[model samples]
Target: MTKDTPPPPANTEQMNSPSFKLAVQDRDFLLSEPMRGVRFMLEYSKAQILLQRAKIRSTIVVFGSARFREGGPNKEPFWYEEARRFGRIASQLGGALCAEGGNHYHVIATGGGPGAMEAACRGAREVGAPAIGFNITLPHEQQPNPYTTPELTFNFHYFAMRKMHLAMRTKALVVFPGGFGTMDELFEILTLRQTGKVQSLPIVLFDEGYWREIVNFDALVKHGVIDSADLALFRFADRAETAWEALIEQGLDVSVGENDEDLARDM
Candidate 1:
């Protein structure tokens, strides 16, 4: 319209700029409702690729309360120490710490928050084995503990996807004292085993006193809610050594070389 104005620059068009790119740079489009399925695939694919690359064939998932910090509550200290001990034991004897090259079986995995989760990751660290943390985004912004392997730590926005990753490669599940989240994961795996959705794996509930007092499995059988034989799906352990032995008895393959003392260092 103005005679004095020069022509627009050749590369100045908005569509040609990097900011207008839709595939990778458009965060708003990625978060849109229609993109929910894409988000789910992204969460699944990212974890799957990394795990395969790391040769993590199997995982030992640990579930517990995020509130159970060391020296914080009545049973917190014991639970924290025992969980840590079990981590070390499992990692060392379950072929995670083996020098020979092969699939890393029974590697420690956790919810990637504080408390017993931290203890489990810490246990894997003590044995110089990698641990995985499937951390979920929360209102309070839960973070992965320091002991989780830096390359293996994962963040998830969807609980369903996070739970899927937890169960997909799990060879065993060790439940310590926890509240709602722990119980949810425990029963979920048990249901999977019950329904034959997942092959049977060792499920151990640490601290027999706490679990027995909290959940009356016998009552469930007595009420005809669950069959009496269903109780055989899991076992109880009062200590770290006992928990490891129970896992072995339940068909966990332990390496022959490592001793209890060698695995229980810095305790």
Candidate 2:
């Protein structure tokens, strides 16, 4: 091999092969079906790391319809404004606005889409508080709302992992009117509570009339599908402040700006 001839191009084909690409750098390899488990882990770990970095200790999850609008049909605007109010009130009183001891508590969390999610995040934004948006990729619902803190917003491909992240750190759950997806989430949480799968969570369903008309709790008890005592798993509220008061009465620890031993222990 002469120095001027460059050794016959040094067999560039081998180096350029797809298999020679680093595993982490190989998008096709990482996205393949065989790496699904790895993708799940990546989804889980990425959010976990970002949340930890933000010092978000707990969250108040708000689930509601993504279809509602400020001036659309029915009481859409009312519900939207109430959700916004709830977000603002909760952030102000629930320790989200205060990062005491390097930890933020009961920060607002939502599905990271339109309607109620947007309202809640907007409220947090209006109050200058950080909120979380756990967005899932879908053909109809990929764009995240504009209000969630950019650093704290996350995207996931797996619905199970998204649900896990939503459920894990929630201190309280406030659900507004929604369709099938929202119902699925609400029931799963109720089932988890019914089966003692998780710690006690304060659940408040907004709009008592709407929910009662939608799902007859009395009928369920009459049919013996669910125990009558199970009815106590969640309460109903018609207004935003009432919902906040209900959560407080239901044992949500609104003790803000405290680095108490109990809070630390829970952390």
- By TM-score, the best candidate is 2
Clashing pairs in 2: none
Instruction: Score every model by TM-score.
Output: 0.89, 0.92
For model 1, the local distance difference test gives 0.87
Model 2: per-residue Cα lDDT over 1-267, one tens digit each = 677765645768889999999999999999999999999999999998888788888899999999999788889999999999999999888888863446788999999999999999998888878989999999766799999999988998899999999998888999999999999999999998899986688999999999998999999999999999999999999999999999988889877555455544554
RMSD of 1: 6.0
The prediction achieving the highest lDDT against the true structure is 2
C-alpha RMSD for every candidate: 6.0, 2.5
Task: Give the Å shift of residue 100 in candidate 1.
Answer: 7.5
TM-score, model 1 to reference = 0.89
